[model samples]
Target: MSLQVIILAAGKGSRLGRALPKPLTELNDGRSIMQQQRDNIYEAFGRDVSITAVVGFKSEYIVDRFPEFNFVYNEQYDQTNTSKSLLRGLKASSKGGVLWMNGDVVFDPIVLKRAASIIARDQSMVTVNTSSVSDEEVKYTVDAEGFIKELSKTVRKGALGEAVGINYISSRDKAAFIHNLGVVHKDDYFEGGLELSIANNGVLMEPMDISDLYAVEVDFAEDLERANLFV
Candidate 1:
């Protein structure tokens, strides 16, 4: 089946304190963060991959910039968070497995090559950065058989690392994920859905560690600097 990808770009990104959407923030190389993400997706999966970006805050700006993407507008973006935005994106995507990422992430293309193999096998997985474990980012711990168990910022006990923005859901698990995302409370991150699916639906998701490759979700000035060095 052809690849379907979703980018969750519906937030105001108030943390950055910028007028522009976080995804549109310009990198040192002159590419917007979303544009760089698009390039990375193309490099890994080719241009034919079907891409849908979920837009809400400043939707028109992102919509006009990337004419290549199919957009799903989240009307409640201002009142909600990633769980709601991602629910819309998943609903808009094809029935096949979908790969998605936070629009603000700047990642190396090599990461997606590994995703390709997992996507081929129709296995669900979340990409992780084993090197850093910050209190602010979503952290994770695997279950007994190596599937992701607990995933959230609250994970303080045995966090393997941060679940770096990028992730995949197989066709077999997509509906379950969608259901969980829908039931999650507003303001909950997308990780809440994943955790729910794992706990409630028996979905098994592997953690694909990518600490060796550079992937930074730009949330602040310091993160943008770190992302630029690798980009």
Candidate 2:
């Protein structure tokens, strides 16, 4: 099936303390983080993917910067979080398989390839990294059958590792997935909506281990520095 890619780039990235929005931060060889993601997706899926980017916090700059994408502006981005932006994007998404991603992450193209391979078969998935675990991470745990049991920042132990903030939903599950997202309060993270869908809606985003790949979400100033080095 054809795929639609939704990139959430609405936040101001205050923790990074950068003039550029987090998504537009130059990370690798002067290419912005979003550029890298777009390039990687193109390399992985080629013409099968269409991109819809949700932009806020200098929305015009982001829109103008990436004219190739279909843009949706989050008018209340200052008052909301990723979940709200994702809901908006879902309303704008076409009917197909969807790859949802955060804009702040920089990752190898192989990560997209790996995710695509898994999603093609299982239809729903979340990319995971078992190589690094931090107390502050939003960890995802799986039962023995490889089904996701929980996803939260508070889980301090027995987590495989952090979720890469990349998720896939098959076209068959689109309506239910949107319903799952819609029931969430605007204040909650997108993950909260996602968890709801898994428990009540049966939207199974099984964990796809990608510990061998290099990926990093640049949240803090130090994370940005580390991302540049890692990329």
Candidate 3:
């Protein structure tokens, strides 16, 4: 099975308080976030995998930085959310299983490799990395069998797991899913669209618990500091 990787880097990332786009922000090691993510994908899937980046805010910066990878511009980035950004990326991706990921997080290459293995084994399955989350953040409720039951933003009464911003989706199903996604509320996030599809179509998502994986997502200055510590 062919594997394609799509990195969503179109957000303005106002929280980062940077002149450049979030993905272009430099890390402590001097490499930009986009470069780190691209390198991570390459390491995980080798050179065979087709990699594409969805660009919008600061698109020129991303194009200048990563000339090797194919880029799809999300013109409605400011008007829409991650779901639209994902739709733009999916439209540009090759017709096969894909490793869809968020660009803000720095992940271990092994996570991508593991997800690819699962997708290759079962095309119907979707993989989401689960990690212990704080009480203030949105968390996903998973059943005993590891299927996502609910993706809630409200603080739950019990334990909850956070999505690590990585996913493995079959392109055939993804296209159909995106088509159905158009019926959902426009302001809903990409995850919400997936949840809608899962609820109505019985699409099964397998959990890949990566609580042990060393990954950092740069959302604010504090997150950047935390990333330095982890890196």
Q: What's the TM-score of every candidate structure?
A: 0.98, 0.94, 0.90
Expressed as tens digits, the lDDT of each residue in 1-231 for candidate 1 is: 679999999989988888978999999999999998898889999999999999988899998999989999998989998999999999888778999999889999899998889888999999999999999999999988999999999998998899998999999999999999999999999999999999999999999999999998988889999998987
Q: Over the stretch 120-198, how does candidate 2's per-residue lDDT look in tens digits? A: 7747888888888787777888866788878878776678888888888777777777887778877777888778878
After TM-score superposition, the amount by which residue 19's alpha carbon in candidate 2 deviates from its true location, in angstroms, is 2.3
Once fitted onto the true fold, the runs of candidate 2 whose alpha carbons sit more than 4 angstroms away are: none
Better of 2 and 3 by lDDT: 2
User: Which candidate, 2 or 3, would have the higher TM-score against the true structure?
Assistant: 2
For model 1, the superposed segments whose C-alpha errors exceed 4 Å read none
Q: What is the C-alpha RMSD of each candidate to the true structure, in Å?
A: 0.8, 1.5, 2.1
lDDT of 3 by residue, 1-231 (tens): 446888889889999899888988888888887788888888876777687889899799888887888899988778877788888788777677677777888766677666666776655443334556765444677666767766545537554567677777665567666775576655656777667767887666666767777667678899888777655
Residue 161 accuracy (lDDT) in model 2: 86
Candidate 3 matches the true fold with a TM-score of: 0.90
Where model 3 places Cα greater than 4 Å from the true spot, the runs are 123-131, 155-159
